[model samples]
Target: MRHADVAQIVHTIAVETNTPEETVARMYADTLDSYRADARIHDYLLLFAERKVRATLRGGNSNRH
Candidate 1:
């Protein structure tokens, strides 16, 4: 994903969850890295990372898809 796309996702998630942008950005970067490690297809990495971060901030399990 582009840097601007990543930034937009971070901003959206932070606003939606009422979390700090710094916190969301960190979460996004960590989640993206984790996905990158095992990913064969790069198409949805950002989307999956965004969802995972959102789920995490909302008190959901990070282990789920």
Candidate 2:
């Protein structure tokens, strides 16, 4: 997916989860950073990062300020 698409996904997820967009964006960036060494394709990388962001929101793993 494209960067704009990912941003939209993050925005949607943030709204749905009632979390701040900045926080979610930071988490998404962090997720991407953590997965930087992985050999997976770009699509999979975005999928995994988004999944991590979603899980973090759903599981209350984020600071949520």
Candidate 3:
């Protein structure tokens, strides 16, 4: 995925999980750098996974539809 997309995911997770975006992203980046293609973080990249992201990021400002 593009770094921007990954960034969005990180931001989504941070907002939902109440963690710092930088910290969450760094954890993924560092893990990806370590595991390369073996990164488990990819699970969050799937279509359904985006639901969690969207649900978290979804405020009254935007609609998923």
Candidate 4:
């Protein structure tokens, strides 16, 4: 997916989960970076990042890491 699509997904997740967009963006960037070295398909990168972010936010562990 494109960067804009990923940004929109992150923004939506932030709003839906009541988290700050900036925080979500940072976490998303981190998540993306973590998988950057992997050999997985690039198209699914955002999906993986989104799931990690959503889980982290939902679990209320965002502040810890």
lDDT (CA) for every model shown? 0.91, 0.79, 0.57, 0.81
Return the lDDT, model 2, position 47.
74
Which residue ranges in model 2 land beyond 4 Å of their true spot? Answer: 60-65
Clashes of each: 0, 0, 0, 0
When 1 and 4 are scored with lDDT, the better candidate is 1
**lDDT per residue, candidate 1, 28-64, as tens digits?**
9988899999989989888889899999999998776
lDDT of 2: 0.79
Best by TM-score: 1
- Tens-digit lDDT track of model 3 for 4-53: 88878778778877878877666656544544455556554343344434
Judging by TM-score, tell me the better candidate of 1 and 2: 1
Error of 1 at 59 (Å): 1.0
Q: Give the TM-score of candidate 4.
A: 0.77
By lDDT, the best candidate is 1
Residue 21's lDDT within candidate 2 is: 92
Least accurate 10 contiguous residues by lDDT in model 1: 56-65
Q: Summarize candidate 2's per-residue lDDT along 1-65 as a digit string, tens digits.
A: 67899789889889988999999899888887777666555647777777778878888553321
Estimate candidate 4's alpha-carbon lDDT, on a 0 to 1 scale. 0.81
Clashing pairs in model 4, backbone N/Cα/C closer than 3 A? none
